[model samples]
Target: MARTRTLLTAGAFALVTALLPTITTVGAAAADRDGPGPVAVSESRGQLTVTVPPGHGGPGYRLLIDEKTLGVRTVRAGRTVLATNPAGGFAFGDQHATSVTTWSYAAGTLRIAAASTAPADTVAVAITPTADRYDLTWSVAGAPAGARTVSYQLSSAGHWYGGGETSEGAAQPYPLDAGQVSEPDFSPASYLMMEPYWYTSSSVGNYVRTASPMDVQINKSASGLGDFTIKSTDSYASTVFVESTPSAVYQDYVEVVGKPSKSDATPAEIAQPLWNSWAQFYTAIDQNKVLDWAGKLHAAGLGGHTIQLDDKWESNYGNLTFDPKTFPNPKAMSDQIHSMGYHFGLWTTLWINLDSANYAYAKDHGYLLAAAADSTKPCTVTWWNGTAGIIDLGKPAARDWYTGNLHQLMSTYGVDGFKFDTRFFDDSCAPAAGVQAGDYQRLGAEMADGFDLQGAGVRVHWGNQKYGFVIRAVDAGTSFPELRTTLRRSMAISTDGYPFVETDMIGGSLGEPAPTKQVLVRWAQAASLMPLMYSSTSPLGVVDHTTGKPVTYDPETVQLYKNAIARHGRLSDYLQAQARKSVADGTPIIRPVFFDFAADQRFYTTDDEWMLGPSVLAAPVLSDSPTRTIDLPAGAWFDTVTHRVITGPRTLSAYPAPLGVTPAFVRLGAPGAATAIAALSHQS
Candidate 1:
């Protein structure tokens, strides 16, 4: 009976195996016959295939990366849309080409030209191939009516990461079906960094090579492969880079777009942790309060080389003067801060309040952005504080005027630098004289050229990386979830090619409840591993609002804070070295874990962890629970807290993590690993 049962099971397996190949062959034959009408012109180079179908209703083309259809686009009278047939394959619908005008692959380039219907006279796509990568440029000549957008599609395979900065869902790859994503512009308030780039786990990368306003719209097909509809109001070019790993793809992107350029080396000040007065006082700051806070931080052995005064210090929003009411003698305060061995940095914004001293001067001289509704008057828009006019940084004279005030502050009051804030120039009051938003953002960074280190939002331009300021992570709240948000956004921004990353304050920002003792300690631990560790609320004096008194953290908790700061200080040299190297070759000092371990698929979707350059991996506990899991990449890793040697690709579950320590590891033989491990051990 047993032999009969075995024979029957083997016969059933043989029957299915015999039929599998026949079924697959039939499916392939059917798929091959489904074409996009008749191809008027076809060309192939490297791994790309360009097929142009003659345009009658519209001019369109389809690209296949190694025979896999990348996407299909058709331009009509008014709008352009990507067409996909019901069978999850490429199609042109009624936009099938009538004739091919120019079909030529000359001088290592493939150009396919076609004639379309009304509104669009002609449409063409030029492909420049290099190895496995392709530079795709499409031009739509004479579209006189609706939006003049540069529309194209990209493969949305595997997981997609990069649409500027957002704490919401940033730790995870982009949702394939999110439709139209929010905050698609270069607004730091909404999106901390607005970079026109994205990379997928499929080892594909895209960099929209335009300073114009561009929005990345993602739409996924029934099959996981999807579309990246780049809806730009202006014409632009883009590159689709392919490499063996995502890191290599990013390297190619930086080389093509242009690496960050400033001085030959990144300034050393970028690596130091600093204390600010925003969350600590919330604009209730005075000269005495500034000095007192600095003193308290010093006495507690917590403050770094910089003591920054945040919002509400200036008399008016854009006037750039100390408030005489709160800060009676600004110079004396600056001197006191300097005497305490700390750089005195003030918070500065580009908004000019209507009631400011310089409002009349700015409005009369056209230094402020003119209102689009009425060009004769300055554009007065509402912000967090109130209605104000934004300075036209796009204009040379206006930029000089703003920076002149900044220089005057430095010369008169011994101000070291500024923490530039509120950088977004919304569409309502923007491009007064047809200036692009990118121009304003670039000019803003250029203003910091002759100044000290200034923390600002990440700006993407040809050489804007040379601005020499740390890219600050978005401000977070005081809860465990917000702590996780800070990590997510910091990693996201760094991954976008802004290397020098600064995290939020040790605790949460204002309006949120004070961080709990455990939260504060954990936040400090996580921040300690980042490039810059900033603190606005000290762990020693977290306020218990219910009792109207300080929530005293135990000695152990205070020691944890000290250890975190000490760890950052000890690792400052290594961090600065990595930063300087980034200035040379556009590598990020703080990046996501998958960046270094791209071959390990286990970490492709991991977001809670990060890498410090190439040596250290930081997986700080970012939740209420102290225990966490860490997936170590391939190779031997030295555990900092436990002093244990672990091998990967391995995952440690329920790792013993307590409030006293951050979970970090050093790859055994990476550059500077020994020194880093020793310094971290000293802190422990």
Candidate 2:
């Protein structure tokens, strides 16, 4: 769904999400040890080595992936101090915790209890084996009476990654700052845990399953240290999963959180070409304008098979009904759009704003979140459009009320699907009695139960991957740098495990000022190859009302747009098949090069180039360079555009990319994926 946004006067950027990532799966085997009883060991798929210092307690372990040391167990580094604040909501583990209470080791698991005399708080640490990862749980069973929080840390010695939850985060690594605590939020600034999960090229990954109210964060300290910390609200049990590889590890994570299977969503449905009206009309929409655009999209031969009407159509935020003044006779407009052979989708947020038609009624009931005694004060959060009473989907009646409304949008209005979108990704929602931020998706997921969900989240929780929607990149601008950031984030997100992905329309989002013809054409070409052919920002330009003539671009860019759409339309099935595979395992359709060619360490850090599904290798010209180098692994790659056979495991000179033609190659192994692309595209 498109965003209902006011340009951030500051940066004009938008919120974002990290796809299919969390948890690692590892399995059991014989236990081994280099130290005595307390220092037991489990050599499952990987290995977990525990160390209980010669005493009653103080037990920790070092995680290893592919026989590489993952991270050392948690321990306080210096002299410990104690502070108790009654009004405090933030706290960290004491710097000096040198005492150990007890330790035990069994088949593929380590359990240890520790405490310090200064704070008199007892902490428990357990390491369990899984199918593709090691699960480390740190729980504090008893806390000093007045103390509101305690902390724990896991230090891994290597370059860190996975906290790419900011404006241009995916393009670079972050300093180990606690994500939530630092209060640096964009729509979905890494849902804290310091973007809670990460991995290293040394072949390791981490996901912190923050147990309820507790805030966990991880980052690489400036002083050559990678740290993972969990700061609990009170007593907490924070779980961390450490594993290996972008694909295998991410799949392992998804296996636990769960993603929708092929049945829940058809690749064909996802492959449908979409035309959104946000860019063309913004909020200045009307029934006539919508119909005109729908007609224009198809008539222009743009291949926009489906139509998505973004914000401003609704009377108020979260109000499902179309505004009477702007969209009079909604059904008629829907019918007209459908008559033109286009699928229709509406947009909505989950909250019920006070300004909305349903707000008073929702507030009358217990549908909105509220503080302990303040029944009149609706628990609302302020964001892009003032304050609104948020829905507590956990309340079945409220959920049914919201979803029931959605069903009507489908049956009555002929709306085929929706984009479940959100703008505020901040962590202040009122969860049902004991619900935590991570569980926020409980309502978000259910809201999408019976629809074609073409939705996205600016900020999402840990279990969001289970929702199984095509995740779009954060709204991007036309600036070349934004495009580069988008590419990097796409690779990171794909590797993080979100495979079914879509990008912003070619010229970028409404946030970007108008783009140049060159930028627009190239952007469209890149987007055309993506799983979903989308245009939130319409490719059409200003139109003459009286004459009905196209006004914006020089003819070349417009023609290029049509051609790109037609080319991609021919290969929709190929892209769909890859999506099916993604649901089966955790394979990212748009993946980092290393996911497939793992043996080649050179591709481990590759960013500009990527695999579209399993066959097409696309290296877009991000800069103004006429040509760039194509790095091929030790295999044969057939240049789709050039129709030339190229051997890999080598770097070769590439010619400049034509305006809309990217330098792409088809892996000989995936003949169909490669050949089909080869036949449809070319190099300049």
Give the candidate number with the greatest TM-score: 1
Worst 10 residues of 2 by lDDT: 79-88
lDDT of 1 by residue, 330-403 (tens): 99988888888888888878888899889888988988887767777778888778889888877879888888
RMSD of each predicted structure: 11.5, 12.4
Deviation in Å, model 1, residue 93 alpha carbon: 16
Pairs that clash in candidate 1:
54-97, 54-98, 55-97, 55-98, 56-98, 261-466
Model 2, 644-683: lDDT tens digits are 7888888877665667566677787773665456445543
Off by over 4 Å in 2: 1-102, 113-123, 129-132, 140-159, 167-195, 211-227, 234-245, 263-268, 372-376, 423-427, 433-437, 454-461, 542-551, 671-684
Give the Å shift of residue 229 in candidate 2.
Answer: 4.0
> What Cα-based lDDT does every candidate model obtain?
0.63, 0.55
